[model samples]
Target: MAFDVDHVLAEATTEELAALVCGSGSWHTTGIPRLGVPPLRLADGPHGLRVTEQLLTQAVPATCFPTAAGLGSSWNPALLKRVGEALAHEAIALGVDVVLGPGLNIKRSPLCGRNFEYFSEDPLLSGTLSAALVYGLQSNGVGGCLKHFAVNNQETDRMRVDAVVAERTLREIYLAGFQRAVTAAAPWMVMCSYNRVNGTLASQNSWLLTDVLRGDWDYSGVVVSDWGAVYDRIAALIAGLDLEMPQAQGRAEAVAAAVEAGELSREVLEVAAERLLALTDKAASAVRPAGKIGHHDLARQAALESMVLLRNDGVLPLAPQAKVALIGAFAATPRYQGSGSSKVNPRELDRLLDTLSARCDVTYAPGFRLSGELDDDLIDEALLAAEDAEVIVACLGLPDAEEAEGFDRTHMRIPENQRALVASLSEAGKPVVVVLSNGAAVEVADWVEETSALLEAWLGGEAGALALAQVLTGEAEPSGRLTETLGLRLEDYPSALMFPGESGQVMYGEGVLVGYRGFDALEREVAFPFGFGLGYTTFRYDSLTLTDTGSVVTRDLRVAVSVTLTNTGERAGAEVVQVYVRNAPASVSRPVRELRGYTKVWLEPGETRTVIVGLGIDAFAFWSTPHERFVVESGVYAIEAGPHSRDLPLSGGLRLDVPRLPSALHDESTIAEWFADTEAMEALQARAVARTGERFALSEQMYTVVAGQPLRRFAMFPGGVLTAEDVDAVLAEYGRSV
Candidate 1:
């Protein structure tokens, strides 16, 4: 079962190595028969398995779990891990090796059509949840591929558009989650994105694929390109890409020729081939259980945890005897998943109309066409059905065409027809409960107040409808939180000005500000903030404490935070406790507060418990451009805790003693830079007194004019108070040479 990689690489022929580096077909790798490497099968679906049947036309039926957007709101990594384990069981039954999944791309913009497949807008949440999923899958003997590797945010012009971002922004916002996932879980494989980063395609960018991913993070896993991402096969290989996915004609022969013609090194070819052989060996030798496992119950529980109750006016938990009118065609046939490569053909799907009719006196009507067309008859029928009902339960969502994999959304509003149906039902003066089933946030400020209650039941897979019914009838409680901010309008987003850019490039002009970070920075009001959710019961936060758990000189700072939470209501429910870190005033711009740690807990009526969440060095650090690394300036940091981002009721402060980062100075260094250092300032003042019998001093008026001048320019000053020798002494003693 354990084969030596060096031995296999040494014995592999040039042709065999070339073939091993690329996939043998659409869903399999090319195995070396003589070397005992068996081909490994791959499948799609991050939330389920989608193994293709013969001719690659049809896929086997599998359990369709909640999409990533739905799962992200749960804020329960433990639940995601169980989902990953269940998915691994199905993969093992279908003879699959790697499941391409757990996409960790930041939700930079809500208009990104593929937002349904990603986790959260913040990096810490995304990375932590993805690491849990990866751990579950790999522990169960199946591989999890963490993907669309880096900054593949928008779908428009995805294959060719260049993502132009600054180094600090890239490190802090775009690449932070990937770093966390790689460092924590060590996924078996990482899939490169189709888009270009900076100006180089991800498949051939040595800096990203090699320097950062491999050299910086010390990742040893195989680097596979997204399907059809490789434009230059040899270039990708030389850039540290271990595999090219899918089947391509003439790829093996071209790779072999490149090596023979001295365009590629044999050593690089062998390294790539060795990793493939090792992957195949592990897959072929894995030991898995022999029977099937059921996950409908788990899927239903996940759906329950993922439903966010946005607003409630004491109308939720409808009485069992209350008559209900369920409106919308989606109630009968739900769009449970997004339309794209990750879509799965569910083994079974639950319908809300059917589930509700079985429990209470319910009337159903097709309120609007699935295409979002205005039909006068459907609207009139819906109004009539609501006349005799005690409550109107309206299910609404964006049509499949509005959000998909290949393009970006043009607007944030639901179809006017769906909006019209809700408006008509609200006029009846009865309590209206609007349940949304979209993959991302939709604008609701205009009409949300019209309804008595609003519930965000995202694209919750096959068992979603059953879960919604339970939440409505007091059988279950809503515990989901918002992973992305819901702004009042699409134009309110900071990224809206330059999203999906033109001219073959998109600029990340907002820098580190994305999602709730941008909203907090701009002091903008949103329909709902990140981590905001309402359950049946209320929780009070108090008793905040912070403890340092690691040494300061080691530069590995860890703070243990504990908060006492109490259930102050009459019902049993769950709450997601969010913890954020706010740095002291600094030179660089930062979010008002960044999410550092979080936990989900269940409490009975009048129950109290102390929850502890820890913060590491990365929590208080920012990417310093001058140092070209993550640097934490010594300062006192405020630790805030509450149920949501905006409603922090508990606060504590901790002072960290971080060593001062060294600044390299030279002849061209600014005069302000020299004065900022204590030692250099003393040297310059001493030189001034020796030359002119007076200590060095500059007036505010003079400083404004000369603060930006180079240190060497002081030699040109009147009377030569500070000479070139003085500048040289400061540079030599207190700074590195230029």
Candidate 2:
């Protein structure tokens, strides 16, 4: 039956409207039977449906696909869309109206325990993949919720920590992904994060929810709070937060009292009721019949694409009949997904030992206990099993307690027992294939050189074990890539010193540089760079071309790039063609190169294809503090294409003549700005030297300090040679030249 949202809102009393804005039951909002409005049930997703029974302790069985970290490595939007659709089908089957998913928060630090739920460190990749997932979910009649709305990067002190970030940094790096997802996908709902942003709680930050999301991005959707994220219901509603989750006690009473006392406007309550009713109307038509949707096959396919081959020395594609030693407890009991609210009760989970034993002569041994002290007998048993086999596959990873949703990881190293197990297995005098299963990047620098091959299966969902077995035995190819940089040491990270924060605040000192951008800027060696991955076959890139190399001032202008890719090896494989743009003579400090566009393509042996990717004006733009918006400076930008960010094999240049005029020069402008005017620099310097004589013959330190001072301030110094008139003349000259 069709529901009228306006009629429902007009009839709702202040008490009813207040109750409607917040949840009436766990994971559900109250529905007005008198007005023909039904309750909306939300489910946890991004990978699978996480429907819980009473008390939220027991979860209903559902399909578990690859986690966001693993999916991000696939770099395949079409695949993500398919996964999203499968998740939506499950949600409908379970009587869920919305799926809380597609977390677009940037992987700012490797130590973030919840990195498995996020996408990539780069905004372009994260945003694009998130948009695809959102589209797929909404297409199936299920509402998609883009979550952790702003700078909820780390899990430590998440409920109240303040992200003390610069405005430009927030715009360019941290918030860019969310902006892209909101503008492109138009998700049905956006989940405000648990933490505070710039001293204001995310639920009550009007600049973020109202000014940016609803106003600037034109998002016409409900703004829901993270579970238990609401501190004040009336304040959150005024700030544009339409709903609070988990049915907080006394919230309705508090809201009604606030409205009656004139503390909260009645119009705010009506607007919130209207948005909730509208969402109910939108979801009413898409509800499907109640039945289980089998997604195990889809889960396996997703896991296959999400596995990353980090290092290989031609020892992969194990023979099906070869004798193999699976030496790890995880082989018997897999750690397929992370813990906390997003944890899924999978319908079925495949074990690598069971799958591999069915096809080959496999000797399995528990290398070490997943918890408790390591037993010497178990280590000896694992060593014996490894020595008797042709090849040893050691499954090593962090315990669930080490990395989860409540806190940040203190270090990047794997558990001590797991490291020991790998060390012992490495000495078995056979080929060692180290398979890492973790939520975030772990240090492989210690033992990576000794291992013959490495596979980074980042918390692949329920069918991950089957996918691992297939990739090992030549049933599938490893096509996934690194979404975050695998750093050599934890201290080497740009935000290492300030990670997890202290005293309720975290500073984004790295600015726009994060992940691979940081490694490139510092010229540091990483275990694996972003966008780096390997497959059985090799690809060669050639014939790079740019469609429009001419200048353009508007943001709407786009440049098309085409490159020929050839599979020169003897196998079917996939390749992710990454395009990066470097600003020649950057106007401000920026990364050496930023990822602009990328696409994954499959090729047969000896196949050749030309891939074309378009670059928008935002690709070459940066957040300008003076302009309070993104600006593309008039300069030449070099576009480089290759397999990864660190290895660009093809290059082309495009000159953009943006029509953005420089800001009007004033007396408060830095002295360095005045010196940059070549027409006025010589005259000003000569006058200074003539007036101050030897004092004007300043040292480098003095020059540095004086150059940064405002022109007006420098003119007021006791022995200052330049006056306000001289500064005015310089500005007049600059204006004339423009």
Candidate 3:
């Protein structure tokens, strides 16, 4: 397979362009022939594969992959990579060039109705997993599309609401996931989100499209607008949005009109067309081979892997013969995945009732209680089921309707019926296991005390029932880590104080303090901490080594992590090693410790292997404003590595030298650090002052004065609002000030 010669086609494509665009046809329908190859099509992403009777039958058969929340629950990059490969196989088979997937939007709010389709609240977890998935797809002949490009944090007013995040926070948390995906996977396409960032719609924001995507990341892939996401086609093209999806016929003509009208440039159009051609070349020359995958089996495996056992008391891994009285309507009709685009038609689905029925005397009972409201009759039914059962399995959580793709939930409590049902079951003294299916974290404080065990099964797609069976039967040990913290309530969040601001331009008061940072900073203990998950067998960590010097670099210090397993519970299992780094003492307020690295290992009973995790400077570094670079501030770092964030094996005092000189700061550092020697700060402060002329800095947001002179008010009336006179006065003032 020869790679597309982009440089050649970029200029003329004379023979190539003649075939592609020429075949696509000209203004006069009679002038040119129609395109031989049908145009590429895209389906809904994020939740499930949204396809219909028309698109699926004709095009290449693409495999619909798991949603973001389910994938996040797994926390296994290797698994994500495999999912990408599998989806690619489906896409190639379906003749689908680009599988619209790997949505990397940050889970900004728990109330966000569409969270089931998204991954973690943390950017790194979502970014890392998404990147792996992308790599797997592109490695084959398919192009993986990383979607909802910028600050598409919510679903309500998603197409109209503006995400007014600061430049720093935008770079660090909100856009980090997309950035990581681009940097790691280099996908053929990046799908633009239908939302506004700052004041400009993402579709028309040059800062997001041109400055961030092309300039900063050097992302050479084509960027397509979400279907009907385009408003100003010319502005979108000028800002680096290459293709309008679904091939809106009038869009390109409008673009051409704009170019001829001097509103845009032929050069910009050429760049977009070149990028589009690059995608065509890549997709056309793929190594597609016929392969059959038992999607149900794979989905079941993924579901089992993704399920997190939040709480347990030696009552889990139920005996196959146990009279498990299953309660709740979700048992029969599972909310396998979220609604809206990205919905895929699974070959088959497994319900919890069917799974339990296959192995045990399952007394199926739908305790007819709405989630928040407990009907007396439903409570009686649930209690009756519990009366006879040795153990009870309560399939509980927000119904699909409770959390949809629009509007935030007013609160996070489980409905009254589910709560009442659980209370009745608890009183019966039956060992109970509560299964939760939700997109984001919910307040589980009330249910925590009574429930014997709790499992968070985020909307698993396809083999959801089978996956639930495996976890219950102990086929695959639960090892998924939590991607977000389960807070007491919405008010517990620091951002909850200021987010969803009045009017427009919501200020990012917390700056980069997101996810666990909010919980850690406030010293509030959440119901469940990030990375909290359980495995069937217990593992141990020892032989901790940290070398400042010698054969190993500081980053690769042979950090021996060993866990001797006796299969304490008569079952084969796997465990996820979560490594977090804390700057015990730092220049700024950092998350108690950020997730630095992690690993998932499978070990048999009585088996032991020493796992050595390599740490790097990048792990210690944060976005340093003063240094204009990723800097690892000097401090006594604590490297705690274990299963889950709270259950980490403590290792204290891994020290590193801090920056002491100005030369250490990169060329881009525009600010001064407090710890920096006075000489460095002095030089940087002087340079900063000179750069802004001590008057019109980047902070002022507009040109106010030149050099050291301050400009007079720009035609200000009683109120300082902009007017035609104000605009002229500003121009005049700047002219005189300069």
* Lowest lDDT 10-residue stretch of candidate 1: 285-294
lDDT of 2 by residue, 337-360 (tens): 998888999999999999888777
Backbone Cα, N, C clashes tallied per candidate: 0, 0, 25
- What lDDT does model 3 reach? 0.68
Give residue 50's lDDT in candidate 2 (0 to 100). 88
Give the TM-score of each candidate: 0.96, 0.94, 0.83
For residue 225, give model 2's deviation from the true position in Å.
0.4
Q: Tell me, by lDDT, which candidate is best.
A: 1
lDDT on C-alpha atoms for all candidate structures? 0.89, 0.86, 0.68
- Candidate 1 deviant stretches above 4 angstroms: 53-56, 291-293, 666-671, 684-697, 705-729, 736-738
Error of 2 at 710 (Å): 1.5
Per-residue error for 362 in candidate 2, Å, reads: 0.5
What is the alpha-carbon lDDT of model 1 when measured against the actual structure?
Answer: 0.89
What TM-score does candidate 3 get on C-alpha atoms?
A: 0.83
lDDT of 1 by residue, 1-738 (tens): 556677778888899899999887788888878876778888897888888843246678899989999999999999999998898899888888899988989999999999999989999999999999998888888998999978899999999899999999889988899999999998889999999999999999999999999999999888998999999999999999999988789999999999999999999998788777777777667776663545898999999998999999999999986799999998998978998888888888999998888787999999999987899899999999999999999999977888988898989999999989888999987999999989877999999999999999999999999999999988999999999999999999989999989999999999999998999999999999999999999999989999897755686778989999999999999999999998777647888899999999999999999999988888888998767788887778899999999999999998877766776577888778777777777877887788789876779999889899886877666675788888888778777776
Give candidate 3's error at residue 611 in angstroms: 1.5
